[model samples]
Structures are given as C-alpha cells and as structure tokens.
Target: MYQRFRSFFLLAGLFLLSACTSAGITVANAPVPFFEGTIERDIVFDEESKQTLDIYIPDRATEERLPVVIFFYGGRWTNGEKGDFAFVGTTLAEQGFVVVIPDYRKYPDVRFPAFVEDGANAVGWVHKNIGDYRGKSETLFLSGHSSGAHIASLLIVDERYLEDGTISAIKGFAGLAGPYSFTPEAEDVKIIFGPPSQYPQMQATTFVDGSEPPILLLYGRDDEIVAPYNLERLRRKIEEKGGQVQAKYYSDVGHIEIIGAMSWIWRYKAPVVDDLALFFRENSDN
Candidate 1:
C-alpha cells in the first residue's frame, strides 16, 4: 500500500508539474506600456505536423516596417514550452520592435535537423509574415539563451540548415551565455556540442565571416554552465575573418543573470539591448 501511494503521488506530481509548465507566466506582472498589444497564434511551418510559432508585436511603433527579432528559448533542446516566455514577448514588444518566439520539437521527439529546421522556418515565417504584424525590417536578428543560443550559432556556422528551410540570410546574431564551441566536457554536454572532432564547423566562431551577420556576444564572468572562452573564441574568429562582431563580458553576472538583466527589472541590460537595436537599425537602413 505504501508503494502504491508513492507511485500515485509521484504521477500526480508529474501531472501538476507539466500543467505548471504549460500555464502562462505571470505575464501581467511586467510593467504595462512596454507591451502595447499582443498576437498569440500558431503557424504550421510544416504541413504534415502542426509545427508552428507564437509571435508578438511591440506596442509603440511609428510605421509598418518595424524591425523584427526572432527569439529562441533554451531548454537543452528538451522540456521547454512557448508559454515559458510570455514575458519576453511583453518586454521586447514594448521596445518598438516585433518579436517572434517559437516552440520547436525537443529531443527524443526529434533531433538536430528537426529542431534546427523549425528555427529556420520560424525566421522565414517572420520574414514572409512580419509585415502583417507591422514588423518591417528587411534585416532579421536572432537571439537565444543557453541551448537555444547553441542552435543559433550552429545555424549561422552551418548555413545549410537555414537554406534548407528558406531563411536565406540572418542579419545579426546574439548569444547570451551560449555554449558555442562547447566540447566533450561535462559528459552530457559534449553530446549536444558534438564530439570534439567536429571542432571548427560546430564552433560558432568558425562561421563568423564577412558574409555572415554581425554578432553581438554577451557573457558573464562567473558563468558556471558555459565557459567564457566560448565567447573569446568567437570574437577572435570573427575579427580574423573581417566580420563585425562585438563581445561584452560582465564582471559579476552569472549565466542566468545575463538573461535576467534583459528584463524590464534591469534596464542596464539596455546597452546590450541597444547594441542589438543599433546593429539592426544600421544594417536595415542601408
């Protein structure tokens, strides 16, 4: 009877946890006015399955051709949902830009190309559809936290993934504490970054070149998850290739802190935010 009760409680706990994961965040807590309005819907990028995106538009915009940013949330390529970032939508949307955040299939359900394909298609979707939301930059920017950053880096380094999905070119890339150039260390982490033998191609730095988009890289000095060397390597590579890339390393911020700093609570991250905005503004205006 004790075992039976234990299993029943365990199952109940799991169900409750999943419910919590899917539920909307305290989105209303974010300061108002930053988020003027919102658009919550799904677009089936793949017809066979319901692969889709949940996009949001910034509140105050002057014109129809507003700049657009596509954000990918990190979950180690598993166990993350769209509802997890309702706050991201609210915050960036308020910034006079349109943001599209998408949910891609996670591990065990589908692997690399599947999730990568979804990301590229999500960008294509925005490019093809952002005008409907008044997001009008011919230039598109990509940003992500942790694993999502990994995928972003990989997409730039290995352009095939985007080409396959029809996203053509990405104007800029931003990674916050992303595990770019991650190696076969930390046992499990190695599998996600690919065995060391794949080095240059898998490293986000390898893809930094004149043809590649400008990159604004941010990292925390105290990050325990992804090392600081990852950013250094990419910075050096991009510089070597004559690609425009700027990197900022924070002294006290940690991995998650860097992401938190971007929120409405920490406007200081605004510099980092502005770096991105300026990069887009400069590139798109031309």
Candidate 2:
C-alpha cells in the first residue's frame, strides 16, 4: 500500500510536469505589467550560443546597488530554457534583486561536469560584470529548482568548480526542491552523472565541510520525483560540519508545485518567492 501510494503521486507528478511545461511557457511569456521589471535579454556568458543569460532589473531604478541572484531552471539536466523562467527573474527583480537566468548545454550534447562547468563560468562572468547592471557583486546569491538546484548547490559546495576567490563571492544559496544527495540508479541520470566512481564528485553533500555559504533548502512533503531524503541528508551533513543551513518542508506541495508557486498565477499555492526573498535579505551582507 505504501509503495502503491507513492507510485500514484509519482504518476500524478509526471502528468502535472508535462502539462505545466506547456502552460508555464505561455504564462511566463505573457505580459505582466504590474511587475514592471526591465530585462536585458540574451547576454552571452560563453562562446557557445546556448551559454547565454537574461537579466531582470526592478523598474524603479537608482544608483544604489541591488543584491544579485543567479537562478538556474530545472529540466533533469536534459531540457529547459531560460525563457521558461522569465517569471522567476521578473518576480525576484520586482523585489529589488538583479536576477539572471542562464541557459546551459543539456545532456547528450554534454555530460558530467560540462554543464556544471558552464554554471561556474556563468557565475564567474556575473562576478566580473554584474556591476554594469547596477548590482552589488559582494551581495550575490544563488538559487535553482530541481536539477538546477543541484547545479547551483554543487557550485557553492564544490570549490573546484570556480576559482578560490569566485567561491567566496557567493553570499548565500536557496534551493527549491533540489536533489542534493541522490546516488543515481536511473539510466538517464546515470548517463548524465555516472560511472559509479564519479557519483561522489557529483553530490553536493559530499563536499559539505562547514566552509560554504549559508543555504536555504525548501522541499515539498509530497514530492515523489525526488525524495525528501536528499534534502535531509545534505542539511544534516552541512549542520554536522558547522555550516549554516536552513530547511523548510511545505505540506501537500509536490516537486513542480513549489516552483510553480513562484509564478503570479500560482503564488497562492506557496510563498516560494517571498520565502526566498526573505532568506536572501536575511543572509546577504549588503
């Protein structure tokens, strides 16, 4: 009965994800005048065309430097686009953050640390260039949903991805439904992060040793796609190492719902945007 119930939620989550992708793209592209955020789109971070990012800035501008956030969208490390997360950038930007959503090469095209390397380079670019967008380089934060969160967390916890100085530039991190401690048994995941021997290097939890930036981990109690155990394991490790970490589990929320709650149409489902904003504010040095 327990296994059957979990299977039910897993199938339901899959259906919702399929429906959400199409609907989400439409909703994200729709004009949201109330938010009134300005966007600087398609800025190249790497030589490749897919290695581009979009910046969202709050409408009421001043010379004051706003805190910066680099958010990555999730697609199981296989599919997703920066445009699909336009709402995320705008919503956070409206809250006075300079938000960037980047595009990275997905699996098959590249695998195992290639995309992560792209993520690292993207942050490196932001560290050196965010000032041009009136953002405080010192107050930069990181965030992502699902596999995107995995990538974001790896960049924070794994120092080898970025230069020593670049790692310290990150003020904090927030992960919404991230998979941080999973040892992939699934075929596709294995292909993206495989060869068993390399699994440890792929896990953010493996690198937690009390030296990383503060983290806010948000998970859904009903998420069947990625188990809550992933969040628990990482949080425990970070805490044991004396690193600062905060975690919250929302009742009845599922994998996709947490991120969907960030959208204007679904904001009532959860306070994902508000929670992240507050966490960033509380943890930021700026």
Candidate 3:
C-alpha cells in the first residue's frame, strides 16, 4: 500500500512539474468527488469570442447570497482556457463562495491593455449580473495564479483598466506567484507590453498609491520562474503606500506547486485554498 501511494505521488509530482494544466493536476484530483456545486459554463461576459466565463455555485438549502471570487489562470499571458481551471472553481465554491473563471484574449491574438481591458469588461459583467447567481458583487474578491495574478493585481491597483465603480466594488485580491514587478527580457514578452519606454506602466507595482483594496500575496520560496522578489517588491510598495497587504510563503513549494496545492490531491502539500478562503472572508462584508 505504501509503495502504491508513493508511486502515485511521484507520478503526480512529475506531471505538476511539467505543466500546470487541468490534465496534469487532474491526475490526483479526478479520483476525489468534487463538493456539491452548480457549474455554469460558457457564459459570455463580453462580445469577444474569448470573453467567456464559468461560474461555480455551492449547493445550499439557504438562499443567502455568498461572496464572489473571480479567478484568472496563468499562462504567461500566452496560453490558457477557462475550462482548464474547473478544479479551481469547484474547490473554492466548495468553500462557500461563488467562483468565476473568465477567459481573456492571449498574446499573439492581442497585446497589453487589450487583455487587461477584457479583464475589466469581465468584472463589469460580474458586477451587473452576479446577483442573479446568488453572489454578492460588493463582496467580490479577485484572484489568480502566475500571469493571471498579474492581470488581477493590475486591475485592482492600476485603476485605469476598470471603471471607478467596478474597482470600488472589489473587496480584496489574492495573487499566487505573480510577477508584480519585472523587466520583460524575453522578446515575445517584451512585444506583449512593448515600446520599451512604457514597460514601467505594465507593472502592477507602478500604481500602488495606498488607496487600493486589500491584497493577499502568496508565493513559494522555491519559485524560480517568477522569483520571490516579485512578491516582496509588491508587498513593500503596498505597505509603503499604507495599503492593507498580507503575504504568505511556503517552503519547498515552487511556482506551479503553489497553485497546484489548491487541488484536492496535492492540497496536503500546503494550505493555499484555506488561506485564500480566510483572506476573502476576512475582507468581505457578506
């Protein structure tokens, strides 16, 4: 029995290290039954083809409205799909929050500000329509992993992507292994937010003025892709601006594992989901 479990975990680790995709993480999560929830897929949040989102609502006898979470998956701003993160939605929904996973235009298809604009558009749609799903828009929390986290954090701090009303509605944000501040050394990445001179504007750290909503930054100490300084720089800026910010670092966890820990199979590796739930609840009025 011990060897069987060890083999399973070893295989799972290999999968996670290779790619942080639904197929990779599902190896462990598929065997466990998901918590009761209603998954509404392919709901269009904008006129654009990729501007669709999925909502996961917990099954409950009471009609009490629940806090809403909009999670964006990371793909280095190049690749990702809303359907690829159903596990994320279902897991958070199980924790008593309505979870929304939105699809945005990716690089090669669109450039900076375009994808960010799509994010704002999605938020606007949620604020106007989430009540019908028993979600309290006023208690909305933004969250994402990797590049997705960059998008979410930028929306909250930049204030230019989202409308004032929509931005004000966000109660908190949680970022996992986000690149809050960094220079794009890769040619493709540079082109994604190009014109060299405007690179600073592309960073979330550029807009921290202390008036933004509370933020929770989660990262893995062993994350080589994003580097731990990204979290520290953002956290330091937010704190220097007198904004509410909290950070949690996991030892022995890497970039992909930080978010992968949210899944049931690898959840024992860290308390990523629990920390997210607590942060959201703490910042919410509902």
TM-score of each: 0.79, 0.91, 0.93
Per-residue CA lDDT of model 3 for 147-224, tens digit only, reads 999999989988778887788889999999999999899999999999889888889989999998889999998899
Q: Which residue pairs show backbone clashes in model 2?
A: none
RMSD of 3: 2.2
Model 1 lDDT vs. the true structure? 0.68
lDDT of 2 by residue, 1-286 (tens): 9999967854554455548677555654455556576789899999854589999988665688889999999999999999888888888988889999999989989898998999998999999999999888878899999999999999999888988777777889999999999999889889889889999999998999898888999998889998989999999999999999999989888887898777655577788988999998887773
Off by over 4 Å in 3: 1-22, 28-33
How would you order the candidates by lDDT, starting with the best? 3, 2, 1
Candidate 2 residue 195 Cα shift, in angstroms, is: 0.7
Worst lDDT run of 10 residues, candidate 2, spans 9-18
Give the whole-model CA lDDT for all candidates, comma-separated.
0.68, 0.87, 0.87
Clashes of 2: 0
Question: Could you tell me the lDDT of residue 122 within candidate 1?
Answer: 74
Of the two candidates 1 and 3, the one with more favorable lDDT, higher being better, is 3
RMSD of each: 8.5, 6.6, 2.2
Our tally of clashes for model 1 stands at 4
Off by over 4 Å in 1: 1-34, 60-63, 164-169, 190-201, 268-271
